[model samples]
Target: MNVLSHADSALSLLPPVVAILLAIFTRRVLLSLGVGILLGALLLTQFSLGDTSLFLVDTVKGLVWDDGALNSWNLQILGFLVMLGMITALITVSGASRAFAEWAKNRIRNKRDAKLMTVFLGCVVFIDDYFNSLVVGSISKPITDRYYISRAKLAYLLDSTAAPICVISPVSSWGAYIIALIGGILTAHGFTESGHLSVFVQMIPMNFYAIFAMLLLLCVAIWGLDVGPMRQHELKAQKGELFDESKGLPPGANADLPEADTGKIIGLFLPILALIAATLYFMISSGADVLAADGNAFSVLGAFENTEVSQSLFYGSIVGFIVTLGLAFAQKLSMELIIKGITAGARSMLPAIYILLFAWSIAGVIGQLETGKYMASLVTGAIPFALLPAVLFILAGITAFSTGTSWGTFGIMLPIAADMAMGSDSTMMLPMLSAVLAGAVFGDHCSPISDTTILSSTGASCHHIDHVITQLPYALIVALISIVGYVVLGYTASVMAGFMACCAVFAVSVVGLKYYAR
Candidate 1:
């Protein structure tokens, strides 16, 4: 069971991706992560040094100590830390976060409305998961408490919509990431004759997971057909469930969220605006000069050629932090209070900071082992030629589910799709590549291990595991339909047919589930 035999599977496409996935859903994230890391390390050690145990120890020690792949990921983790600090400082200084909560409490006439409103708010603020979680959870907690909505239900709604909307919306953080990745895939696949197209014309339509996630959210909102962990939580909420966990005091926790702090929210707004403007500028420039890799907007965040998504957030967040201070000074709020707020926000992000490091460390190890290429190769080798597209969807799902990382899977699969397009008929390339993107996103969206899941839980003040459990079934059902859509499209090579089929499934599933479950 602990064997790392697939060490030299020469798999870059399909098979090993599933291995990563299997390790992920084995339930305990830390345990699953350790298992995957150990497995890969052992196999690598065996392949290179002929000592499995030595490899395991070295990988761990290297990760904890050495200046290698792990170091690069740490660099990214630092960005996450900075971004969080900025978010906290901005929220507290402006008082807008607290104002939003107060405003929500004042608006609520009853508990049910409060709970429903929480869900409504989660949808309205659809730009970033961090903002959504911090603002929505902070504002909704007291409101949900008043209405008897349990912590779990609040988290469920928060987690459900947080990344779901971003993935679909053209203007949000998800859009920037996906578009950039799509540009690369297009370039590799020769979607454009010369270089990677910065603007993805067709890929957006094929992003099935994000699309179906939105549909799933719509269904949950309209039908309220809660089931499994979610339904159990809903009942507990109805019964006035309560738990006193004393989850640490993050800075944002100090203020009621989404409140109209003319200063704080405004502070928050300036940086966000800066980020959006920056992203648009970068994307446009990249699109204009498709052949230039350096032209990609993501690559030029704070310093030149720094496309790290977190850096963009960090730069904008720095602006936000400054705005918070400026606004506080203008309001005559003591420097002491501003410092206190920043400290609190950083504290709240401590867990995220740690998780980011660990996730990166693991990814670092996987990268060293060429895990993506290995898995992609394995899957491609084993896949029946006729079922390559179907397998792509499945592998993408498995990869996302295992790593709680749709982005990581996207990085892996997009290249594979490009490579695949070269070997196959040009017509077959786009549809299959689109399926890969969609499936990877679908898997990550619902995974408990997903960062998105964590954000959702924090946003709704829901228990971390509870959010994962509640949202899983719905994600699976949609995944099933996505698989079906890919299959239909695989045979016909028709995006429209696949799109229509998915819509049809959503319609029937919603109606049938509502009728039958009722």
Candidate 2:
């Protein structure tokens, strides 16, 4: 807190680089994040141990307790994580997951069907990445496991689809946040020809990364296109080693959980359906209430823009938890067993919660160090007109990868992207903005510290490192294709041309991958 005058200098790059590299090589997420946090605090405090200590303490304290009050947003999200864990445990212990798997096995033929089902669910639950990541994994896992699909593959399916779908869908939390930002940028730059929502819709075809990533994931699921580390995981899974036991089980996975043979499929479907309904209701109601307070009409888009997503998820989880408990009582599970299951389930989430806490802490320190600002500053110069979109895509990817938050990257880079486009080529504004969106999602997909990535791993009950490593190759493939797409869009100034280029590249990549895989 004492300060570094050159906070936005190259020195700001140290923490994230060190953290990310250490996480990849050592596969120790907590230690890597802790080191990053410590380094950032020291740098921010100019290496004063006392100041660094205070900064570290205050950083974490601020997450849960800010300004002498509980921080509603962060606390609510944490509550949701815990409640989700408890519900998951109850479902497993009561054998609801097993029951559902048994019920589905008759209709679903093989791994391809299971994988496709996962993709379908991932697409359907596009409201929030956090929700999509966890719920889809839980629903798909039992089915996937039945077909000898690796948890890492299930995680890949979850991670690859969640952000891309949310980023593209207008009704999603990510879309709302982004549209609001685009609105501000448009207003500031005096672009009144089109509304923010319209611009966002137009940019959908231009979001090359999001569009292509989903396409590639579907191909992978249908064709069994396993590559790199993912192939190793899949092979091991086929040999009856679903995951390396030595690396430890993922969050919310307890091998000791009891499986009741009498568990009914209704027990599984009811609680999950209830959770989704409750979450949707709360989300709409919360957003509507905010709109009404501000004397605005009740519009779905307006409601989403004002909705408190964390609050809604937390409330929905509470309803889900109650439903789960009622189902357990109806199943006649013993009181002691139920209590034990709840404790175990909550305890399973402790690891994820701890990692998230540290991740958030380091993100705060990174912000104070102006890491994103430093990254953004490097692109503030004369750039080639035809390369601006592709360049912004790369820059945004790097910034989001380093900062571990796509939203943060959007806040820091979107305005810069807008100004650059306006000054250089006003016609390229939409494509440029779309590149930033694509790049942010690309970076978020690769970052080990990203919350969506972590939740994806937790949801699939796979080792966090396995999820990161397995998905990295797939992410890189789509990102490269997206870069090509952006470059084409920049040169041709046609969204269709860019999308076609992406499709051609993707088709070739898939064919090449299939041959290589064989």
Candidate 3:
């Protein structure tokens, strides 16, 4: 049956709103999501008890087994997660992480250097946010812990850099997804003069939230600008209390495996390098297949534009896992121990997997109800042209924050923003589009229900709620600067001037908070 046929207007928004409110108040993510799903199903069935029951059944079926059997994109994602878990487990069990941490301990020297190293590593893995967060968190946690850096801070660094970096990096999976979305909308509207890639390139500078977030991360790393709950966490960390033991920690908290007598850094470096290389290879090859199917000539950018990123990630993880397994065997690790490590690692990720399923289901339900279209209708004709970018930014942020999915927000907002821009001065289109992207990232960064947030905590072995609480202030600071930047750009139509103003504001805010905000 067609799910998108139903459009419930403002009522369509209740599911996500209920989900977010319940999560914040109750701090029970799974229960909140379950209630939200039931509410959505009831709404979808128009409160018919029999249909609602069937809808819930179908929802579980769809999430667990694509349509009927366990297959499709959901399965691919699950496979990737399992492989990643195994790889992380193997690295830790083999003492590769400890080996690398020991090697870096001599050189890193201080807490600031350790934090900066985490940021550097996060930025380097721009291929995918999931990969970035998990890998960086696992690799850096040992070193950060050694330097008495809080797990909350490490989580913040992991999260802030993951989505923000991917969104801005031209060659990333996020960039490819965005270009395709823009291209589809523009193609349908018969507006293809500059091409989607060219437009996306132009919009890069206008991605103020991402630019500002990376800048703030740098400042936090270099100058030790900690404020809000983060500052308290840092203070506690300085007293050798990295995390409150009274509060429950997520799985993989003690990820630093016992050191092997002959452990080498090669165990850690090889799998990571393999994962990156394999993912790139798979992305290009997968894209090439799509291009050939469409009878188009081969080109790196063109192929990437058509690549199946999820599938590529799945394949890459598999390769990485195999390489790690080989290394474990080569090191003469017992088969039983290797299997145990893999199981342990995969078990740690089970919570994240369940959360993802619920998040995806809610997103699907929201799409079915046309919540995005309904929200878009509210703002499409109400705003003045000059303030459109800022309005869209806020709307996108709210949508993403409520739904906990940036891609869903993009799917809902980008077309509407593009159509609105078509009627106004053409110069504003790029900025408005940029605003949607920036706002989505901002919201995702802040939302506790966001998958990246969950993964970041899992990676750092921090309490999930603690990570959410500590990271919110930092995300808000950048968001505030981005909103002001968009407002100024709306009037001046000069990206450079607006960017400089935002940077200055950020710098001043940092200095003020550093000296006076205690």
Candidate 4:
């Protein structure tokens, strides 16, 4: 029955939750993760209070020193930090971020344009969602704040806009990953075509939750529907008090450097170009699009699947960062000056990395327990045929929200969705799988505990809980509309219909709420 794994892993996350609560309440993300990790280890080991001396050693070894433990993901995450350091350094040394911000301010006259700019900025930095959060948060916080937007609201806008924007974008890190996963599904489904083109075309139209969530956020940004924590933010803005920043900048960051750097323009563009090139190359090398049902991974350059793309994009981002940093050094930028900018980026990410590490560890434990598979199996066994798609979407959404990871949730649910699809008509299967993935993202966007959500807050220098409180109401409102969209899509087996309905419903909801709530 795997009872020990289930008992230990399934419940191990509880202590971590308490730790996060303590961290938020105490204003310490790192300390929270440390305490949480220790507590999680204790739960896994069933250590008594008196046995802590030995338990401490073992837990440290297992968590930080073990081959697949914290240290490893720490290393992987370090690569990202280094990359972030280089890129942000490049931006500062050259002046691109400021220039972009200035251009945005000069042109963007309203909230809709601001939100659209955020989306466009997110699209422009697609190698990593983590990077996107930092750039967007650093740049947008000031702009949004000037317009009387709350830090929490800004954080929500940044967080919700980061990953999903990449996921849907044709040329981002997420694009490659989704492509890889879909490719495998396509092959298994006996498709004559390859590289996920078939599934991507079918599923993109059915990603209702993604479509509606963005629409709702954009609507709120423009028309202004203040409810839940948003209303509180509005009231605070009226009083001229906003976020609790440690400095004139966001909390826990340095603004000693001048706000404008003349050289930063070239610095910013270099690393971004490198990051993109590296990503495309990395995807090609992975087992992605190389094979055309004939056993090779590269029948064409454009054929790789999603996981392959994900791995490459992660690695590519690092490679791009190094080259970009080297360019700055070549241009006679002082090493000290460049290093300072790098440190700024890394310091900002410290909280996010801690949360990601714990989230990864939790994912490891849950994976050991096969939690998603079990849940999927349970749902599959209990539900009737007609209700499968809707039920699966709901289940996937809940799990992602609880765990604070849409990708992990999808990794689990995708296979189940594929299995269900393989058993049914291909027409019925593709859109349904997309719906589950979309819903998982919806839930992850709203989850207070999600790392992406947390990073977005950290990036925007907003109070974490404040971000959660404000964002949840908006996410839920969109999700409520999405439910109807998905059900109709499921029944009619029409991806286009579901997606358009989603847009229409969200538009109506945003207008009604803004008008009536007053």
- Number of backbone collisions per candidate: 36, 0, 0, 23
Candidate 3 local Cα displacement, residue 238, angstroms: 3.7
Worst 10-residue stretch by lDDT in candidate 4? 1-10
Cα lDDT computed for each candidate against the true fold: 0.60, 0.90, 0.83, 0.64
Q: Which ranking of candidates, highest lDDT first?
A: 2, 3, 4, 1
lDDT of 3 by residue, 468-508 (tens): 88888888889989988998899888898779879888988
Clashing pairs in 2: none
What clash count does candidate 3 reach?
Answer: 0
**Alpha carbon deviation, residue 501, candidate 3 (Å):** 2.3
What are the runs in model 4 whose C-alpha is more than 4 Å off?
A: 1-3, 7-43, 46-74, 82-105, 109-112, 138-148, 169-171, 189-195, 234-242, 246-252, 258-345, 381-384, 421-427, 500-504, 516-518
Q: Which TM-score value belongs to model 4?
A: 0.79
lDDT of 4 by residue, 1-518 (tens): 11234432446446545655765577565566566556655554455554545555554455557755466544654565545544664565545566665655778776566656666676566545665776566556545655566777777777777766766764555665677676776677687564465557556667767766766767666666778768877778657666654423443244455433555445555666677677667665554544544475453324434325435646877887787677666666777777776777667656555556666555554454455555565565655565666677788877776567777887778877878877776667777687677778876876655777777776676766677767877778877777877777777667667667777777678778887658
Q: Taking the tens digit of each residue's C-alpha lDDT, what string does model 2 give over 1-518?
A: 57664455898989999999999999999999999999988888888999888888899899999999999988998899899998888898898999999899899989999999999999999999999998888788889999999999999999988999999888989999999999999999998779889989988989999988999999999999998999999999998878778887777576778877768888888888889999988999999999999999998988888899999999999999999999999999988878887988899988888888988888888888889889999887777789989999999999999989999999999999999988988889889999999999999999988888889988888888889999998899999999989889888988899889999999999999999777
Number of the predicted model whose lDDT against the real structure is largest: 2
TM-score against truth, every candidate: 0.74, 0.98, 0.94, 0.79
Error of 1 at 164 (Å): 4.5
Query: Which RMSD does model 3 reach against the true structure?
Result: 2.2
Ranking by TM-score: 2, 3, 4, 1
Which candidate ranks first by TM-score, i.e. highest? 2
